[model samples]
Target: MLAKPAMAAIWVNQYTGEVMGKYDRPAVFKVASAAHRRLFGKSKAEGAFGAITGKLAIGITTIALLMIIISGLIVWRPSKGHVRNKFKISITKGTYKFLYDFHCVGGAVSALIITVCILTGLNWSFGWYRKLLYSTFGTEVAETTSHKTPAENFPAWDYAYSKLSSEYPDKEIRMYQNEADIVVGGCGNQQATDTYKINPANGEVSSVTTYEDKAESNHIKGWIYSLHVGSWLGWLTKIIYLVCVLIGAVLPITGYYLWIKRLILKKCHSA
Candidate 1:
């Protein structure tokens, strides 16, 4: 597919950290970010390609999955007095029944988590959906702040880095000198915090905003990614999400087997 190579390229860049040239990484990221901006009106922080083909593939897959869940719910509803049976798996009912219960019951249990993944994944691909989410949640998007300083009079990167590093000694800090301001950003052992602005004029830490100070919308946006990847609650939640994803991955294969068996049985019955 057109998008698979791009995905692989991104995966290599992320997990392997291999670059073709001195400026290869940033150049690749810039191209991917431009593609995303053209397609979705925003750039992904990770700089993955989220252009037309990728977005369409994910969007269609998400819709198909939602339809499957809805249809499964309709077909899975139990008779009024036998409601409990719908949730129970009976291995004693033989192989076909066992497979049926595994597919249905496991799917039912994991549906919500899978749905969350789909929705969050779609949000990453669709700008309209993201805008709707922001509006519904009453959250304003954060704007990047830049300050310009005279080229000849700009403070050194070392000075800004030293001042911010000394202030946040316990935290991990990354500093860069822009044309205007020396921007320093850091976080604790966990999530990334806000960017700290330094006055290039006097080498003073001018402003600081932590994660807690961000708007409700921004918080939700951050949490959406965490929840989608099962990182919000640490390793325990990640384990749970992993299991759910595995179950989801296996459902289609099992369902296809069941369908094929049904077709064979119907042919025998007709004969």
Candidate 2:
């Protein structure tokens, strides 16, 4: 889906963390965002605040996708001693045979990537699913925010950023003062961010939590985009994902045709 690829276009420099196009999203990204996450611009916030229906939609669609994949596998069960032929694609066949081969072969090939995409895509839409993923993977979701108010004076955000930026020159730094302290995050790869808590009054950096300090869930969350877009292994996986995703998109159309044709034939026979 366009949404999967669009999420990959965050445009952050891994070196400087210069978030390019932070204010302006391209037209494709906007359209995909509107369709996939925002329900074509119905939901207000992308997160936990606004859209109940979007979450429901994701959950329902994910279930349906699971069913589709399972049923496809069922239908694609290879005949005895013919597993090799089942994967062979031939355009020379008639339209029905070609479509059937394409559907089965494509589904079989891309099933793993589609499963990974579905699983990775779930965290954005459902908190419960996220929690289940975390717990199942032997991690607890911890709140990174502290509610206590900082000093009356605003935290020394500039000083903190300077301190972190110099220490980790290769990293991209983001800093903000929450209720409790000045929180600074420095990251090299997008996933492995180090978090620093600074004192508001003294501008002192108190604690630094590195990526290694994080749990498996945190690491997995960071890899979600890469895994979903099939970029984890560079172009090799991307090509595989591209083929599989396109096939996935086409499966429903072919499936619907078969279902309708079957119905028509049954009705004709009865008549």
Candidate 3:
């Protein structure tokens, strides 16, 4: 069930040139992202069923994973004399033993990585959590004024786009027009780094805010986002994160099997 969405996300990243430094995302990535929206919902905007489902899934899975890890640790307390054996797979003991060791040890090793992924995901899933995160970073969400603009007097898209793009040659600019202001967001190296507010009527730049110029907390927040998606350290960390996610995907299946096997063996012995 999760396989398709995971693969699609990886596919989108592949085309977006995340693995490489290039930003030339192909048309196919749009299709893949659409599929992602259909599966995970449109993440940025609200009111989509997919988005609601995705959030619910994240919350539930995070709790479930935490329980599993804690319970497993409690049940897996090895004697002091053989404590070291818990970390090693004993292939000589047979397939079942090897699998049991692998599942236990592998899960223990990957627990921290998976926990970080889950907590970060939850931060995006819940509003209160998001607020807390922003507060911890010494920033709050930007507030937009509800001022009105006459339709006939609205700013031209091309004019705003061109002006902002020319001003920030090194950054990719995306323009937004609302009743209150003409806002231009500038992204460099794949993350939004700056914002510009332009006067709609005269196309004059009124204010500029650079993310990097903000407090250290803001930088920490940005790093958290990059780390969540495994893009912080480039290809190497991405590969490691990919592996950890794959292990996370398989843990439930392996755990279920182990449980069922234990039940069967106990029944047979009792008989």
Give the best candidate by TM-score. 2
For each of the candidates, give the backbone clash count. 1, 0, 0
The runs of at least 3 residues in candidate 1 whose Cα sits more than 4 Å from the true structure, single-residue gaps closed, are 1-50, 79-83, 140-174, 178-192, 200-203
How much lDDT does each candidate structure score?
0.64, 0.67, 0.61
> Candidate 2: minimum summed lDDT over ten consecutive residues — where?
179-188
Candidate 2: residue 150 Cα off by (Å): 15
* Residue 193 shift from truth in candidate 2, angstroms: 1.4
lDDT of 1 by residue, 1-271 (tens): 0122232322123234575433224556756555433433333334553356656666777779989988987888778998888888888988888899999998988888898888777776567877776677777543433222322223454566677667666666654343222222222113335656666565466777666675676567666767787776667778999999999988998899899999999999999
TM-score of each: 0.67, 0.70, 0.62
Local distance difference test, candidate 3: 0.61
The Cα error of candidate 3 at residue 54, in Å, is 6.0
How many residue pairs clash in model 2? Answer: 0
lDDT of 3 by residue, 133-162 (tens): 778767874332222232222345446666
Query: Which window of 10 residues has the lowest lDDT sum in candidate 1?
Result: 180-189
